[model samples]
Target: MFNRRKFIKTGAASASLLLLDKQSFAEILPRQKTGKEQFPIVISTWDFGVYANKEAWKTLSKGGRALDAIEAGARVPEELDITNGTVGRTGTPDRDGHVTLDSCIMDEFGNCGSVAAMENIAHPISVARMVMERTPHVMLVGEGATQFAVEQGMKKEKLLTPKAEKAWKEWLKTAKYSPVMNVENGTNRPGGKYNHDTIGMLAIDAKGNISGGCTTSGMAFKMHGRVGDSPIIGAGLYVDNEVGGATSTGVGEEVIRNVGSFLVVELMRQGLSPEEACKEAVMRIIKKKPENAEKVQVGFLAINKKGEYGAYAIQKGFSYAVCNAEKQDLLISGKSYY
Candidate 1:
């Protein structure tokens, strides 16, 4: 909306104003780099991330690769839990009592691997690593994924624990798919935050390399063979050594639709801080379904190349864990639309 007649009347003054406006506009352009981040950091998607961060820190503290730290951390919830196994062995199963798992791993080199709808494995996160290191494929699914896990000498174990099975059975009595609110909080009740979560971990090594891992049992009581966003790269988790890392929790379908994690990193690449990047990603989802934005929950955790991090959620129940040399903080992210 340039006004040529007004500008001509103003003459020299108008020219100086135009030059100043251009200079100000140039200052607002997105920066390509945010500078160096602190080394050896781990962040994850829930209270469980406190434990995951511990595992990730062990490796990072010793100069281990970011990928190793992330894989080790993501496997913790699976190896130690029997009740409400959200990720790894003993996870909640599909509607038909099938305990399928999904996981993905990504390294700083852009190399990645994944498994989807896999069954009977206790450590889908480890199996996913094996896929990344031992196979030529970027992803494996169903029986094929299981076969690979066994081939890697990973034992097939019943992933459905007594507690998880009990929950599933009780859920079947009603078969209601209602997702509850307050997901950004610390409550672990039925249909709470735990019901729609993944052990999604990200790490930055001492050398500044970044990696991420995400593992889940799919949605609680989802239809058999359902594969959620957890095992899908750029959806559940994404890592870029040059940009940052991001992971998602809550509704997987929404994450997949917007490629949530990837969006966060891309925003970071454009000079947004990790916190603002997460907020922008959440806005993308809200813009997609403004009418239903408050009805479901989705949260994103992001860490920039400089080790700075932040998270945001659609509701108030989204919490995460962060660890560095200072300490581990289990913090609830900022709330949104809901």
Candidate 2:
């Protein structure tokens, strides 16, 4: 009763069917030719990105690598003295009044590194790069991240500035916490035009390589150990040299739920323009949570390998900065769902 010949044929047919099912779900579109390529360009989230873009252009204009340029750009915001509690050491503290930071970096070769819920280190982005280049890990968090920074010769400083502490004391009076939409546009800040959440930058260098970086202090008055999407690859940031790069701002939770940046790049790979891809990603979030989408803000900025860029958001007031050889501080308002 053991028919070996028939069993072999049936097993081979079943294996072929399984393979076909896998391919159907994972089919990638062919890379299509887009418009003219713009070499040595940089783009970033928020109006503050203008300053960051200027810094990045310093390297990009000179034909530097995109990875170096984006890191330089990201540092500009981290080193700013007046970031309005949005990024770097001056960022608004967690509910417990501690300043924790998150950051991530991705290079052209698909290499990425991240640090989340880190403290005392001024530049988490640099530590992220060190993680990507030195260690075999993609992420480090909390005390371990801080220890690595110290061992690498980065000094530990009191990140809680007088102004930030004063604000924390004020917030403690009420302690009622809810994320304000468009906080980066100065919607809910007490008295500052620079109040914002995150800075995410993407670049394309002369050699046509793409890289991206995202850094944030996370939501104002978030849970003490809360880590948002800023340091999570494919959520807050993603870069594929062959396809393109994308970075996100606004509510990190919504972005993470949708794997926002990676979705944008994959949509681009499917032959959608950067703007179209960004819009598609935004719509997915809105569709999944129509009620919640009304209260939160989420935005995505994307650039393809051909140098075309665009952005979309869940609410209005989202804007991004662009820097190329022709213009250094160009700002564009992103199209929104609501």
Candidate 3:
């Protein structure tokens, strides 16, 4: 005969036990539903750097990667005629009124590429991408970079615009007689110390991938061919998925002198918070030789996957633009790019 009653009792007990086990497992496992899934992207500009426009953030939100976002955001200043120091149409011109541009890109893989003191290209960062994808070299410069741009089918055009010419003429008329003005002197005021030639971008994708890029019209009034830090790998842009992504803006010489981007990433790898790393790097510049060095203005911005974002500067005021899945805000912090 079938023992229906016993079998039913046993099955019920087993079902209850299984339910309890599942409940226990659920309690033991972490509840990550509230955790951050996708990474956030950040883009910033110091005092004179613009971030109010959300056009760039919109592209990233629409699924554009960091590289796309970087070029898009950078081209804003290039086309709007902002910052006369480095790679745009309005960048300060040399005594001859010729404008040169500098740019660099760092990929998620940590491979970096750049172009320095390049002329005639409106979008130097795009050309830098060509260098990265086409050639095995890390950098290219001047006429060579221009030639490469042409060979890559980049449109060629007059390097100088009317605005750049006006800026150069204005600078010449106000020129003062000083050793700083003498061509024979090492420092011919290529770009005024206060002049800035760089803009930086750091971005983190929804997948936690990070990349950085920097673009600039080379220093205003440079020695016709002087290159600054905008195109230097570690000085301008750096990305290490193990740490974070970093970009620097302001005086390229000072940024390069401090090895700005790499120093910040290394600091983060040593367990320093991104903010601490940025602050430390800027503070180091403040402590450089000759006691109070020329106010070397530099701005740094970074973000780790933890949603922890950081920025610091050697100047009196610095501002950065940030866009997460939620919103976009230009975080204006501190006083300057010291």
Candidate 4:
């Protein structure tokens, strides 16, 4: 039953919600006495986005700003205590047994920030936002990124939890790199599990401001000092006030090589629907590496300035969560090209 189908049609909607410090929710989406409202949306990658979306919903429900909402959403998994260690403190460490984090943030303005190969700090998304607000630099990395986080009053603490330590020790015995699929939903398999998912969120406030945030611990057992597309501006995430926003998950290499998120956004500007843009980006990756197209997974989630949103993936099981005033918690499985 591997790769049962290539495309599975699903419902479509636009998403994004706004959250700012000391902001409150407003009637951002279209509304009627009994008609459906479709603005103030929040959509993100994977199933865990359900929880993350709920946290963001808290802000949007109160009419908070969009950027602040996404920051709150991105921190859910980063601060979560989990056995999979997908993000933040409990995330799986590198081959050298170091827990590094990667994250990025983008706002309605051209302002953006990122941190890569960071260690000993939790909530890289928050740090990324700080970088966007406090400094002229758009990114910081390795020791420098860590130093900046500490200097910004971020807690300097051990990121590798005891469970992660035990897993790293066990992995050292095998030291084999065999990537796996669908491990994020809970399965015992080799290759990689903790890296099977990411939180790529996009939100729009009442004023039509778009914002995005993406965070991950990166692929499990990766080489030391490796930074993936998660923290890369145009690769893992992109936002434009005039057009829309997009965020990616799955294989960072394929995403980075093709500049996936940016591609999706540009396509939106070129008059393509969010779904079409995402599908085209997936096809571009396949066209470049047809041989490995089915071997790895890459999915893109996008939201436009009008609040329209869509997602597409290279394989089955890629899903996203959407929420707004019309709805609170809904999970939608996107079509795949496997």
Candidate 5:
């Protein structure tokens, strides 16, 4: 149904492997294999989170490093489920009931790549990997990305899932616009600055090497072609071997503006723990008042290379499903970190 080689060719290649500027990969290596070889890898998807922890845990357990495990794990949601609407085969439809998708991947070495406003292609994140490793560019979008996919022989297929179609059909019956918390309307009342178009994953390998990636079906009831932070480097996903890796879900725009993922990693680099960095990043966005407001809103999740992790949001409660190297495990860090 999909052109694996065509998809693979979309990426830059030098000597069999997609060349992702070895310099970036070099920054995270010397792959430290800990004595705890049998430990499990963790995967978390909170309240609005998607993807099963087993999807990724299995890959890591098989000796795949964080990046491979994360991508392999993420590909499951991108290919099978429809509820997530942000990653996988069935995605949330736009106001018109058409599905568009976006995705990104970042390696611990700081190499980042993405694709956005995509339609027809099932695995945009894999396409994004091609852009990062095959081409000199970090992103490709819309028809351009599709054309590239086609040129490389990637197949085009229907992206809408039955469940998402049902959702749009139902929403159409009500036509009620929910008053989402907007980041732009900081002074008066908060409104949603960005549509939620993201599902993210962060992984640390047994050696402590790290990687992160995000994918989305775009925002629910969004404009037909709107793209969000899920496909932006440093915005949707970020990783640093010296620090850690992070990815965000909910409201892509605020995440982009805050440079959410990178900010968390930087905080960790500055001595804040993984959880502390995540809390600070969310608070930074929430405390922002544009000369007249109450509270800003945003949400994010993070994991440092040390295997520590955390998540935070401006709302009351947020939880992400997680599968770590320890076994089938889940973590819901709760919303409001004291």
Candidate 6:
């Protein structure tokens, strides 16, 4: 009762079905998108980015430039006195109890500026923009950056808030300095939950121009004068109007070693989706230091010229905010490697 022809036909049909199933499964993965073009979209790292995106949308929805939108977005967290001790003036201080800030801004024309280890400035993002607009340099650091900020008419104030001071006092009791993974998103520390850290934002304007900005307080209780990737172009943030923009959060050292954000944007240029590109960037970090990847968290958020966006992280609890015409105040949990 063996019919070779019938058996072969059935086998072919089964194989076709299996292939179709595989394709279907792939389509449902987090990396897959419809590839539709979205204009005037803003995306930023962390749930706090929800507020930041809303601020950016004010300019973006009004047909403003991507550069302006991102600057406006980044300033929201810089002025907030949140508990995360991540962004802005109230951030957790360095080991010696100095609250230094780092920030960078990039425009659609490849012009960028940054300030690192700068103290006493409440809005470092604005200072960074001034550096891009007024200076011949790409970065300013330490006392020089503080002087520049003051020269530009920004006031110097004590950035350490009462809450931050309390936390620092508590941390000094233990004096244990270890980077905690996912500390930003509801991670319980000795004092309380650290809400978030490091806000990196990217926006696409109605004219299809792309711009990005990154601002951070650096790591909590870090060494004095330590400047993380946030203030380094092509490390914490990169934007190409013709390609896209990418930003990163978490451990800046890991991000800096791999030029994390630039790699994500470049991967998108090579025809990968934003999510796929972000995943590849994270994998590169893991491949370089698999052991460290397990201990610390690093996440990348990217958007393509088409306005399609995606994100990947080394650990869970990394999230981002997205705002567009269709969706506003949306918080998306990033896909993680772990």
TM-score per model over all chains: 0.85, 0.87, 0.77, 0.87, 0.77, 0.88
Off by over 4 Å in 5: 1-40, 47-51, 170-176, 179-197, 290-297
CA-lDDT, candidates in order: 0.75, 0.81, 0.62, 0.79, 0.63, 0.82
Clashes of 2: 0
**Per model, how many backbone clashes are there?**
7, 0, 19, 19, 34, 0
lDDT of 2 at 102: 98
On lDDT, the leading prediction is 6
TM-score of 6: 0.88
TM-score ranking from best candidate downward = 6, 4, 2, 1, 3, 5
User: lDDT tens digits, residues 74-182, model 1?
Assistant: 8777776433346666576778988889999999999899999999888888888888889898899999999999988989887777677777778887888765543
- Model 3 C-alpha RMSD to native: 20.4
Q: Following a full C-alpha superposition, what root-mean-square deviation does model 4 have from the true structure?
A: 6.8
- Model 5 agreement with the true structure over 82-148: per-residue lDDT tens digits: 3344455666667876777788888867787788877789888788777888888888888898877
lDDT for 236 in candidate 4 is 98
By lDDT rank, best first, the candidates go 6, 2, 4, 1, 5, 3
Flag the better candidate by lDDT, 1 or 6.
Answer: 6
In terms of TM-score, how similar is model 4 to the real structure? 0.87
Q: In model 6, what is the error at residue 323, expressed in angstroms? A: 0.2
Shift of residue 240 alpha carbon in model 6, Å: 0.9
RMSD in angstroms between candidate 6 and the native structure over all alpha carbons: 12.0
lDDT of 6 by residue, 1-338 (tens): 21112111000100111112212211112332457757989999876677788889999999999999999988887885353468886688887888899999999999999999999999999999999999999999999999999999999999988877787888788988886666665434222323225999999999999999999888888889999999999999999989999999998999999999999999999999999999999989888887566677899999999888999988776778788897776667789877
Query: The CA-based lDDT of model 1 is what?
Result: 0.75
Best by TM-score: 6
Q: Write the per-residue lDDT of candidate 3 for residues 136-201, one digit (tens) a residue.
A: 998999899999999999887876666556556767887632212111111222234324445677
Superposition TM-score, candidate 3 onto the true structure: 0.77
